[model samples]
Target: MNVGFRVHQDVLRPDRALLEGFAGAAVGNLSDAMHGLYTMDSGIRPVVTPAARVTGPAVTVAVSPGDGLMLREAIGLARPGDVLVVNAFGATDRAVLGGTVLLAARDRGVAGLVVDGAVRDLDEIASLSLPVAARAVTPRSGTSTAGWGEVNVPVACGGVVVQPGDVVAADGDGIVVVPADQAAAVLAAHREVEAAKGRPSDLASGGEARRSRADVVFHRTRAAMAERGATVVPAAYHRWPVPPGPTAASRPDRA
Candidate 1:
């Protein structure tokens, strides 16, 4: 199998600070900030829970599924703070990245990794503290012998077309790609949107509005029973005496 390996040496990169700003930016807001332009699929999820957010300029790789040679090479070629965005043909049956590859990226100061394929060695990767987002996880390891791959080229990952130097921003919500040239503009737009939305209300302040599952069910059941001609006494009013044969203004609390 003559797997042709292609490397584009003159790949363009965005400014480091721009990438950092996107990294620190909200992933949800970034997706909105893109205006439906280039959001990755939601299928790609963090392998480990409580995953850290990753943001950096993309070093795109187009590779055959179940192969890791190109990925390993990409890691070495990627500069510090670069995120390797890999198109693995959406093959999740075999692992494309694992402990060794992750450690290599971490040691090189690579920002993170996003793969449209499966990965393994979760325990090792979890301990390494490197941010990773992928389609799935499998125990099967991939072969590095596959020689066909292209580095620093436009590729598709998680159903999104990614070009070299595109900003890859990922967090709990998933991944969003911002074109290299549009990074600054998108960042600015996201900040504007955030400001316009205003600060979210604190959960503590809304505790009175929160209802448990059982409470909700009970209220719904009471309504249904009332429709059946059954007299319904709401829990709150049950403890008190009927006041003046229930004035029209004294309706029971429905919530």
Candidate 2:
């Protein structure tokens, strides 16, 4: 079996409706629904416009630091509305993606691109208007040699394990991974969160109901923290007195 150089053709994607539910969802709220986990590190941020919000199944790619052969193959294998998630071992010295290949991916109907490595051609990429999140950017391009890498396999990107076909919801906040099998449950939980924050319609209508709900939640949380042994000081930490120390006048002068 070609371990590192193989591609798994079959991937289990979640239902289209389930994925669609996350289209305009905030990554932060989704992360909270998952117990504040499954979020990519802050370093992996939107290199493109922050207004871009995308949700789709992930096509996982594991590429060597300075090579992008497997990534190119993954793009061809990706279906429309699939996010190409590339793991390049967080290498920043060389870029594994650039404008030229990004154009091809865009034309192929790829939803977005998230890389745990560098990428170049920001101007062209912005012009394309495809959502792109990466760890860094560099002008040095990767080699196209058929090297060791894997596609549609579990990979670590930005300190989170991403599985093939997992729902990837990315926005200005960051990227959040929802396991394919648990997508339904996560969506339900996310809806509950939104409800607790007050319906979007209420907030949009400039009603006080949303603010009231927020206040309730904030006070409840504060009380819970106190009950759990969180001490509340009457004054700020900076206003507290410092330990006694010898004053400059009390110290002996040096010759």
- What residue runs in model 2 are displaced by over 4 Å at the alpha carbon? 199-205, 225-255
Per-residue lDDT over 119-139 for candidate 1, one digit per residue giving the tens place of the 0 to 100 score: 899998889988888899999
Q: What is the C-alpha lDDT of each candidate?
A: 0.81, 0.89
- Write down the RMSD of all candidates, one decimal each: 11.4, 4.7
On residues 79-197, what C-alpha lDDT tens digit does candidate 2 reach at each position?
99999999999999999989988999999999999999999999999999999999998888886656789999999998999999999999988999999989999999999987767
Candidate 2 positional error at 60, Å: 0.6
Clash number by candidate, in order? 2, 0
